[model samples]
Target chain A: DAGVTQSPTHLIKTRGQQVTLRCSPKSGHDTVSWYQQALGQGPQFIFQYYEEEERQRGNFPDRFSGHQFPNYSSELNVNALLLGDSALYLCASSLVYDTQYFGPGTRLTVL
Target chain B: DQQVKQNSPSLSVQEGRISILNCDYTNSMFDYFLWYKKYPAEGPTFLISISSIKDKNEDGRFTVFLNKSAKHLSLHIVPSQPGDSAVYFCAVFVQGAQKLVFGQGTRLTINP
Candidate 1:
């Protein structure tokens, strides 16, 4: 089975612009979470979605928002992107109370 | 303050030897700990993990040890191979929070 899939392998956006990244979770998995990894750093939790609702969020601001569809696919939206918003956007999927499997990640560059 | 920390930024080990990566966490609420290996341009891959209740968990040549009293965890790879070289991240999972808090990763280099 396809583990977890994310779209737009790489993206370049200017400051103040908005960007959206997509993810399709692994089969039979219901939860999707987003993470941001800066250069030379580990992945930082952004938020998690369960049952089409956001269940948990990290310290990230509201500029970072997400949506999980009924089919279990997910989307991450960043409004008014700042240069600091540049990072690798990773999407992970898991079953309830199961280990998460990650996608290849979308490399976002906010210039 | 960072909840989890990997003191070593990188480590070099000879093939056929043991490679140990260490991590420490400040949050006592975390019940599960995980390790993830990553290569350039790819997402982290889940490795072995241990729960707070257990001190050790083993899988193949990789073993993870957790010391709850010390709030420390470590990953040991026996007979390390060149292919085992990658950036390893220590992550703590809270029981009900369902999000991973990751430490700054340690890059492991196994030289042949």
Candidate 2:
């Protein structure tokens, strides 16, 4: 009955550091998608995971990557972070693809 | 290039009035469209959606109208309430693609 859940509601990291954010999909959901929302902007798609494999990716750079576990939980990893990397990272879960239920998101601030 | 666009950054409407948020897309391949509402410090929540085959879909006070020919869609909230104030985003799903393209969101303010 629980919706999508994300860990480390807020985080602060320095430039060039790596950070991993976690997400647990809603019950009965098999697909997980990651998105980034900068201040005053809409959420941008990063990638999507299904069947424990990445199925689709957005225009993001190689620094942004993600993984989906067998339990349908997901992790978004960002390496060599820059100041522009500071934003709200949102995780969404769905049965298929388009219809998504989102989590509260993890706010990452890169200094 | 931004495929999805919500040109109006903000909109203000009086309580009990109607609020119409508009969105446009440049891609004709988009088959499914959705609207999401978000509050500060929180992720977006699904509001309403429409597929390419349909021109309109409604849920209570919220209605989404799609004009495929124009590659445009609009969300209308009738008798808007103060609680309706939030940032609304328009999203498009490309056929056969699992990813969604999002617009720059419109901040709606319902004044009482």
> Per-residue lDDT for B1-112 in model 2, tens only?
9899999999999999999999999988888999999988788999999999999999999999999999999999998999999999999977566877789999999999
Give the root-mean-square deviation of each candidate in angstroms.
Answer: 0.8, 1.0
Q: Which candidate is the best by TM-score?
A: 1
The DockQ figures for the candidates are: 0.85, 0.79
lDDT of each: 0.95, 0.93
Error of 2 at A76 (Å): 0.7
After superposition, which runs of candidate 1 have C-alpha atoms over 4 Å from their true positions? none
Model 1 in CAPRI terms: which quality? Answer: high
Per-residue lDDT of candidate 2, residues A12-105 (tens digit):
9999999999999999999999999999888888999999999989889999998999899999999999999999999999988548999999
- Top of the candidates by DockQ: 1
Chain A TM-scores for all candidates read 0.99, 0.98
What TM-score, over all chains together, does every model reach?
0.98, 0.97
Q: Looking at model 1, how many pairs of residues clash?
A: 0
Please give the clash total of every predicted structure, in order.
0, 0
Candidate 1 chain A weakest ten by summed lDDT: A95-104
